[model samples]
Target chain A: MFQPEAGKTHLLNRMSIKIITYLSQAPASTDEICHTLAVKFQLTSDAAFLRNIDNTLHHFDALGLIKKVK
Target chain B: MTDKKEHKQAQIEQQLALKASEDSLSKNKRRRLLKGAVALPVIMTLHSGAALARTSNMIGDAPAVDAQVDMEGRLLCAHPDPTQPQIAGGPYDLGMMPSGHYEKQIDGNGPISLDNQAINCRAGGGVVISGVAYTSIMSRSGFNIM
Candidate 1:
């Protein structure tokens, strides 16, 4: 969950849900999803931002929401 | 004496050149023989190693058990030996069970799939359907039973 430089709350949970929905259709790697999210939100695709997405992906993996495709 | 010395030197040079030519041919043959000697054992070793690995992974006289379902047709039985090398990286090795393996309670339905059979057993208790044992992760709600 990245805090946007504004008054709006960081919707990490909502993004997690969206990520789950995206993964439900097809298996995607962390990098693929991170790049897509970065493009969709117009966020800078830096290490920190990618790390946040990877964290969410890992959380979903732990919960069995998404599986890492070989 | 100078002429004789020069003739002797030329004769020596001719013999040296002839010996060099013969040695080149023999060197090529020796190199080929060495390559054959080294490559034969290396290839044989790799081939034998692969065959041995295959044989080691084989489950000799493994039980021929078939997948069975309960009378209600809502259960899946396990037949594969978990300890077998053949099944090490198989589907059951990981979470072969679907997410619905533990759904706690059936939601407003008369028709549920075979995968949701564990839902009837609630939490804290495991359900063994058709010889397949399913251990619940959550005591009330949630998933993964294999």
Candidate 2:
């Protein structure tokens, strides 16, 4: 994704695309996103799925794409 | 010599000078033509070289795989050879999957313009999906596996 502010373009994987698209519609908690992705990806395990989603969420937090809602 | 003879000699010299001048003009014209002939190819060579450079830099560090973009600046899937060009299509809905193509992970902080769709992917390679950061940079380049 291209960040005009940063003047940089980021290349994303499929999973990232899913998360961004999901977030674009509305904000959701980490667990909500993790659950949605788990179903879509047909993930069998919860630990790895949650970890990946959490990591991605944290990364996005750093990027400021989404924020933690109170 | 007689005045008449002198006059005749002068006329002859004048004719010779005129002929020399004509010859000189023709030589100059030919020299100009030669220079132009040589310069034309050199100029063409320079232009083609620059064109090559721009093409190579078009994608910056992004892989040369065929990809497309939608009207809304969303990165779609790969083009099927002759059917679609790498940068063809309209705005693709965010949630919907574009066309079918292998999912290639492009990682780079390089600038990607919506105009040329020039993407620079240089970083780690994997299927990892990181979080989204807010930026004016609207489009992300990728192909849908569907």
Candidate 3:
């Protein structure tokens, strides 16, 4: 009775891969991850933009992809 | 009799091998699904943001110090030193010392030492000269030095 959606595939870009990979390596506070992204990838000027990435992490967590240790 | 036994054993081995392969395949699929679930949206956002910022120079321009301050503030707030009392109306002067007499002796003796020249052999009695330096600094600032 359970059916997975057919022909649906999730794709991630390189930068996202990089960010997630970094996060997976260690449990970092959201701000720390955002700083790393900004410094390493030159992502955005607004520090508040980090909140968007935090939201993304929450999404990943909901999917059982990542977890918040702290 | 040997042939029949061998055939039965082979069938058993084949069944085990098939089950093992199926299990491994299912595990791989589950792992891939998990990875996709976690990685996909993050990647999408990064890609989209990059694409949008490609036309402008403002991408990832956040000041480094601001980031450092944010990180430091987060760490400080999470596990602050218990000994450091919280104070109001200014930066918590962690370096400030309380208004009291602290004694340091050049010689290892009680309150008094008899011979001044013997001070070399025995620890000398050097009182805190005075808290003049500290008092001046505290009085001038008008801040609690505790």
Candidate 4:
């Protein structure tokens, strides 16, 4: 079995919390999440930010936190 | 008595050979007839009828059928009715018949007018936005105008 790095888990946990909070209110697209993360979290529109969001979402999916309906 | 048995066996072998030759000739004749143009259309017609019967049987055994049109006047996915509409919104809105609905908005083309106001509809509970600019460069040009 492969395990995530300690730093990676910590970063994912923070992003997952924010995403769950937003998604709980209403369903949003990936673009919507990106925009919200930029405005609320002050995350810049950089490759790192985008990659982090994507990886965190994938982790959440593996954990069954959210599902893709369409 | 041994000679009599051997004679009967020889007669049976000759008869079998003659029957086999007749069978082979009949098969050849049938093959020639099948290769002719007259036989082609007859065989094709029978095949078509058989295919139609098979398709009809399959359609009869299907669970259910339903259809709907999208915002672009195109047919969307097929699903059971009363479940959800395949597409809904704009000029296609027939008002709540247990079907889905789309919100209206200005498109990313031309000038914003009532006629140009495109509706966003949901197909089977998923939102569908039409005439929106995609991520491609050509679509980005259209988005820039918006």
lDDT of 3 by residue, B1-146 (tens): 69999999999999999999999999999999999976643322221221121110011111222211111121001111224432232112222332222212233664322233223211321111112333343454322311
TM-scores of the first chain across all predictions? 0.70, 0.85, 0.70, 0.72
lDDT at position B33, candidate 1: 97
Ten residues in a row with the worst lDDT in model 1 chain B? B42-51
User: Compared with the true structure, what per-residue lDDT tens digits does model 3 show for residues A1-70?
Assistant: 0001111123456655666567545556666677787888777837578777777777656644455552
Residues A1-70 of candidate 4 have per-residue lDDT tens digits of 0011111112235556567667656666666777788988787868888777777666665654555643
Docking quality class, candidate 2: incorrect
Candidate 3 at B65: error in angstroms? Answer: 61
- Under CAPRI classification, how is model 1 graded? incorrect
After TM-score superposition, the amount by which residue A20's alpha carbon in candidate 1 deviates from its true location, in angstroms, is 1.0
Candidates in order, TM-scores: namely 0.28, 0.33, 0.27, 0.27
Q: Summarize candidate 2's per-residue lDDT along B1-146 as a digit string, tens digits.
A: 99999999999999999999999999999999999976542100111111111110012122233334334443333223232122223111222122232233332865355323323211221111111210111243333444
Deviation in angstroms for A15 in model 4? 2.8
Q: Per-residue error at A66 for model 4, in Å?
A: 0.4
**Candidate 2 stretches greater than 4 Å from native:** B1-146
Model 1's TM-score against the true structure: 0.28
The true-versus-predicted C-alpha distance at residue A38 of model 2, in Å, is 1.1
Compared with the true structure, what per-residue lDDT tens digits does model 1 show for residues B17-37? 999999999999999999997
Calculate DockQ per candidate and list them.
0.01, 0.01, 0.04, 0.01
